[model samples]
Every structure is written in C-alpha cells, then in structure tokens.
Target: MSSRASLKANLQLFVTRRCQLRCRYCPILKGDSLMPLATALKGADLLLGHQSGRVRLDFGGGEPLMNFEVVREASAYAARRAKALGKDLGFYMVTNAVLLDDAVLEWAAKRGVLLEFSMDGAREDHNRYKSAYDRGLDPYAATRAGVERALRAGSPHFVIVVASPSNVRRLAENFEHLYEIGVRRFDLSYAIGGVWSADEEKSFFSQVELVLTRHARELDCGAVQLGNARQRLEPTVLNSELMVDPDGSLHQMSEWMFETTPPTGEAPFHVGTLDTVKDINSLRWSRFHSYYTLVRLYDGRPDVRAALLNNISFGLRVGRFFRASGARLGKVPA
Candidate 1:
C-alpha cells in the first residue's frame, strides 16, 4: 500500500446476506448468513488504521438490522478507533426500512448516521415488486411504519426509488404518493441489470417531467431536492463505492451488486480481503472498472450489455431533460 497519508477511505459493509423480502429485481439476495463480529472488526480496522485522515463506514445488507449486533458493535468500534487515531469518521445505513424500531431510530439520530431508505413510491406498486411474495407480506406496509417513525424522530435520511420498465408509467403517481407521506427528499434511479424498451424510455422521461412539474417549487427552494440529476447520467456498472462482503472479502460496488450471478472474470474483482488489506491504497484495481472492459467481460450476455448501455443512454437523455426543463437539482449529501 502506498503511504497516501491524506487519502479518505470509505468502505461499505454487507453485514448479512439475509433479507426479509425477495424483490424481483434484486441481484444480491442470498441465504441468511451473517458476517462474523471478528470479520467486521477487522474490516473497521482496515479503514481506521489506514493512512486516511477521513473514513466512513456505510452498512447495507440483505437486511443489516438482521445482523444489527455486528452493525452496531462494529460501528461503535470504528468510531472509537477512528477518534483514537485522530481521524474523521461518519456512518450511513442503506436499508429497506422494514426493520426500523425506536432503538434504531434513536441511535441513528444520536450518532448522526444518515439512514438511506429504499422504497418505491406507493404501497400497491411497492408490494407488487418489492414484496416478500413468497411469504405474502406487503413490503410497503411493513416499511411505512418505520419510515414514519424515523421522520418523526428526525433521523438524517433520504429515500431512493428505482424505476424500471415495469414501473416507469407509474413513476409520477408514485413520487406524488411519497410526498403525501411526508418524504421531502429523494433519489430517482432507473433499474439496471435489465432492458428498457423504446416506449419504456419515453414513458420514463414523461414521468420524470411530471415529477419535476409537481415539485418544481420545492426543488427551487431547496426544501426537497432530487439528488441524482448529476449521478444518474452516467454508467453505474463500474460504480466507485468499495464493497465489503459478509465473508470479509472486498470487491468494487460494480461487482458486489451482481453477486447472485457473478459475471465471467476477464479479471478478478476480488480486490482484497479485510484479513490482509490494511489500507485503501492496498486494494487491487480490476480491469472490469470500465464500460469497455465490462462489455468484453460480459460477452455473450446481450441482455446485460444492453442494460449497461441503456443505463448510460438514460443518463445522457436525463441530462438533456434536466437542462431543457430547467430543473433545479441539488448536490446529494455525502
């Protein structure tokens, strides 16, 4: 590892592979295997002990609260270690909001941990796709209570809705529905790992236009901001977020998102493991970090290639729309 003393290390940990719901489009779902406490602590040390002056730990999961012990303990450990090392530290949790409770909400508020919620607009639409269809549980119903509690508790948070071909037509209605429920900020994203047809693209843009029109005033006032006008207009397959999986293994976010059915390796995505990596500089770089490389590595899989290209296409088109519509989008908070 290079002695980059001023580097910032931001590590995202997948504390558990267990989830309560089986969303139709999720690519990272797996059995209920939890990350051992020792594994998570080692991961914390990788960042806290690094030369980085600033460090952040973001926790996600099949459902992180399912392994709340690790999330809570490792986070506390990291905070203390970072403080002792005279490093800046921050935390965030990406979750479905189904498992939130008073304890979690209070802890997040006190710790200043940003809670990123994954919810797709309305109940009917959410349950239709994001539901635990196998268990006949309504995901929207399960998460709404927790979301409300967090809002009341004043937890630092925002909501993200992933729009796909299946739900593009209802995007406007869904965005409106979320607003009615008191969510003031959002990140609207197109679903990846699948195709979006011509009609779907047109519908998606129209829906976005409607959302902008309805929320224009709030957007201009910065009361409610769309976080992704800048981010959404690019290829996300080679995302920059570094991911730490349950087994203490590390990979790039591009590789981690598709963990369920991994792509053929033109080059390995296993950058390093927490067991050995002591600094972010020690992390190995993968050839699959580029769109061109991903295209070659994902050969013979036309669907995946098409989806990747479509995502980039969406970015360009959306960027045009943002400029033309004069939509005011604020920078997404870190």
Candidate 2:
C-alpha cells in the first residue's frame, strides 16, 4: 500500500435519503433510510485519517437537514477531530431550502456550514419541477422564505440552478431573478438524463454563454462572483470525490450507484465499507489511480475535454457510443 497522500480532498456523506419535496429529476432514492450516527462518525473518522491537508466534508441527501441531528453531530465531531489532529476542515451541505428555519440557519452559521440551495429558476419554474410531498404545500414559497431567512441570519450560502430540457430556455431569466433576490454565487448544473435535441442544445449553450458573460462582466467591476466560474477558472485537479452512502459503503462516484450495467472491464468502483477497511489510504489510492488514468487519457485531448466540460448530453452520447463499440469488439470470436 502506498503511504503517499490520496488525491481525494473531499468526502460527501449521504446522510439521509428522506426528503420533503418530490423533484421530478432527483436521483436520490427517497425513503426513510438515514445513516446511523455511528456510521456517519466512522466515515468521518476514516476520511480524516486517510486524507491529508485541508478536507471538505459535504453533507448531502434527498435533503440532509431531514436528519439534522446526524449532520450537526457529525460536523461537530469532525471539527474537533480535525482540530486535534491539526487539519483544516470545511463543512458543506446541499438542501432544497424548503426545510430551513431560524434555528437551522443559526446552527449552520455558527458551525460555518456552506449551505447550497436548489432552485430551478423563478416561481413558476421552481414549482413546476420541485413540489412538496404534500400537494397542499407550496414548495416555491417555502424555499423563497427559507432563502430570505438565511439572508437575514447572515448565513453563508449559494443557489444551484438545475437546467432540464423543459426549463433550459428560461435559464437566463431564472439566473437574473436569483441575482435580483441577492444570490451572488450560483451553480448551473444541467440535467444529464433528459433528451436534448440539437436546437435545445444550441439554445442551452447560447443562454449559458450569455448569462456567464454577463456575470463575468459583473465580476470584473467588483459586482458579484460566480462560484462555478471561479471553480472552473481555478487550477484544480479532478481529485477523488468519494461518496459514503447511507449504508456506510464507500463508492468512487455517486453516479456509479445508478449505473445499470456493471463496470466489467473497469477498475472496481466499490472499495470497502467503513467497518471493514483496515487501510483506507490504499482504497483512496486505488480510486485516485483509476480516475487519474482517465484524466491523463483525456485531459490533453482538446476535443474530448471540451465535449466533456461544455455539454453533458454530448459527453454521454460519445461515452455510450464508444462503450458499445468496445463491447461489440470483445465479442468478435477471434
């Protein structure tokens, strides 16, 4: 096992699968499943022990605040452990913002948890995609109130806009609306499952280019900084972003859990469980190596890298087309 530090700098804990809203494109398998306190803490401990330097512990879920106690406890524990071990620890969470309240906001503010709220576009767009589990509850209103409450509390947060085929045309309008509501930092994540036509793809990129250009202009004049743009412009490696599922199983990519076909000829995706692994560094090393190999293979190639970073649908199309060709070649009976 290599004693060299793993390339992973972030660990995402899917604390709970329970959520209050039913978003149309959510990938989370919503249920009552939640990570046990012991499991969450153990995963945190493992992450701190194995990874070096500054590490980010991200709490995610159908809505992580659904199991707020676990999030609170695990974050505090990780903070203390990191302090004693002389490590820099950062905390983050991804939530719909429908469940946020004054108490939650205050707690997260004191703990310095970077809360990311999901809002599609404006009122109509948001409500169309994200609705409360109970039809009577207005998700858009609730989320708006939550965002206001966080702003009042001076909590550190940002908005993430998910662009689907249905709402791609309204991307610029939605961003402008969010900006008007005092959201400075934003992330635009396009839905990967939808069928995007050629016209839709062109429109999507056009809108993205327009919005991002305007935001960059704003940033230049000391107006607002776009979080996603900063992330892209900054020099950062595709480090291992490990996901600890609710069952304590460690996986390399969150999407791997949803893969219909097994990764037959690729490196193993599931490394080990928190309770079973003796040397976490070795597991991290293996995962890092697998991803690094892919990065090296594609990073220097302009066509491949641009296709991957610019458009999700194009990337998926290329990936599937290549994988199918490979499978056919494997069955040549030579």
Candidate 3:
C-alpha cells in the first residue's frame, strides 16, 4: 500500500510495568509503579477506538511474558472486538522469555500471538553482557528456553540483539551464532542508559552499518531485516508501526520512543500521552529524526529552526575536530 493510504498496521501495548528480569539497560521504568491491568485494558480500548479496523497490537512490558494472563485476556478481547467490528486482528509479544511457559505459548498460539525473543547470541556471548550482577539469574538460558518454546509451538519468532561497545566487535560472530541455532529473523537495537557515551553509540551504529554492508548477502539470508531505533525515522516504515507504552502512551517509533530525552532536561523521551493526541501531527517529529522530515520541516525560525541548525553544526564541527585529533570516527558502508 502507498504510505499515505496505509492505515496504521501495528501497535506495541505495554500491558504492565512488572518484569522478571533485571536487564541492565531497560529504559521503561522509573521506580516500581506498575500500571494497573484495568488501565492497560483501557489503553488497548483507546487504541482500538482510534484505529480499530486496521491496527494490530504487540504486547510490551518490563517483561510481557511476566503478565501472561493480561496478554492472553487482552488478546482474546481484542480479537473478539475486531472480529465483531469486521476489523483485522494481529498480536505479538516482546518478551525476555525468562517467564515464558508452555501454557502461555499454547494460549498465545490459540489466540495467534507472534513471539519475539530477546536472544543476542550463544549463551556465553549473551550472558557476558546480559547477566544482572545483582539478580544472579542467566538471561541467556531464559531467552533460549523461550525461543525453544515458541519454536515448539510453531509460532513465528524474532530475535533481538542490543548492540553496544561491549558487543559491536562481535557482530559477525553473534549473527552467525543465532543463524546456526535456527533463528531466521532478527533485530539489532542500541543499549540505552548504559555506560556507553555518545561517541560509543555513534561508533556502534557505524559498526552495524558496516557489518550489514559487508555481509549483506550472508546476513540477509535471515527472514527479517536487522532494525533499530532509527528504523522509525524512515518514512516508508513510519505509517506501518506504532509504539504504545504501558500506560497506553502511543509513540511514532518503539526504540527512539523509549529513549526519548526531551530537547532538554531529564525526560527519557516523549512529548505527551496517547489519550491526549488527537491528530497525526501531534507525533514527536524531531528535526534530525531523518533526512526527509528534516528537509520538510526546515523553516529557519529564530528558535526551533536555529536551535536545530546550531545543533547540527556543532555535531559536524565536533566530528571534524575529532578527526583532526587522534580520535577515531568509525565509518559504515553505504
């Protein structure tokens, strides 16, 4: 379908704030306030009200699998509503997989929930970075078990790997390892709120681009494209997806939506909540979000525009200055 004509195809709904795993880089929770299940259901209803016939919802959470009952109940309700309203229904779960179980998988299969497992690579590679020093549980094993369960249930599955300074050097090995283990689809996202700095984040992006460019043929053998937060900035993909938080806050993109730090201050990222947005233009459209949006919105105002231009210029100057010094600026192939 053409971009303009396409109705929103997907939605990510945060069903709960609770999680079983304590991954080091989770950006969702501030403390421990879990969104009530009633509120979550209302949020789903709000989304369905907005795009009932066309939207497919993906269950999200601190660990979506941790709230298996909510996932199952919400799916059933949505499916029934969609069917009655003559709208299409689709479901997916973004899970740590630590708490995924056969009963949950069976229920999901019956309700038709697509499963996304957080498996970076082999147990050793996955554990190296995933182990929560305080939690003392193996995330690698938990993820592996979840993937196995999904495979057994014959559910479509996706694997997500978060790239950082610690993992960039091992991209090839990680990709190869997941492929060998029967994971056909995968995604790569950046680690948020970790020990990495801006330079490290930029370098990680460069490395992923280079890896894909150099090994496109081998890596492209997988069923899904390796994607990240920047994927939302691409115009072709924007209308096709939506990121709804646990409280039912809707975002234009999933990854960038969560990592959203307000233009200033300590806000993680987001302008407002889903309940408040009444039009398409209310979406957070950052100037540097993508080339298309940047060009379209560049009006050279005294405030917003000048600030954006200044920011861009400063980044460019910094890059040049870094090159002049002994600092490294990694390059990714086109």
Give the number of the best model, judged by lDDT. Answer: 1
TM for candidate 1 is 0.89
Encode model 3's per-residue lDDT on 142-242: one tens digit a residue.
Answer: 67877877776677666787665676667657767776767756665545333444566566556555655655564445343443311232222112255
Find the candidate with the highest TM-score and give its number. Answer: 1
Ranking by TM-score: 1, 2, 3
State the weakest 10-residue window (summed lDDT) of model 2.
325-334
Better of 1 and 2 by lDDT: 1
**Alpha-carbon lDDT, every model:** 0.76, 0.69, 0.57
lDDT of 2 by residue, 38-146 (tens): 9999988987875577888899976898888999899889999999999888888998888898779877977888888988778899988897898788998888888
Q: Choose 2 or 3, whichever is better by TM-score.
A: 2
Local lDDT at 93 for model 1: 96
TM-score of each: 0.89, 0.78, 0.66
Candidate 2 contains a number of clashing pairs equal to 0
lDDT of 1 at 137: 63
For model 3, the stretches where C-alpha displacement exceeds 4 angstroms are 1-9, 133-136, 193-334
Residue range 1-334, candidate 1, lDDT tens digits:
2343223367888999888888777877578689999988888888776566877888987889999988889988988888788998889899888889998987786667988888898888888778683576678987888889888988888888878788899998888888899998788777777777889989988888788778777787778877665434245555656778899887667664455655665633346687667777656443235454466557767767777787667766766766565545644354
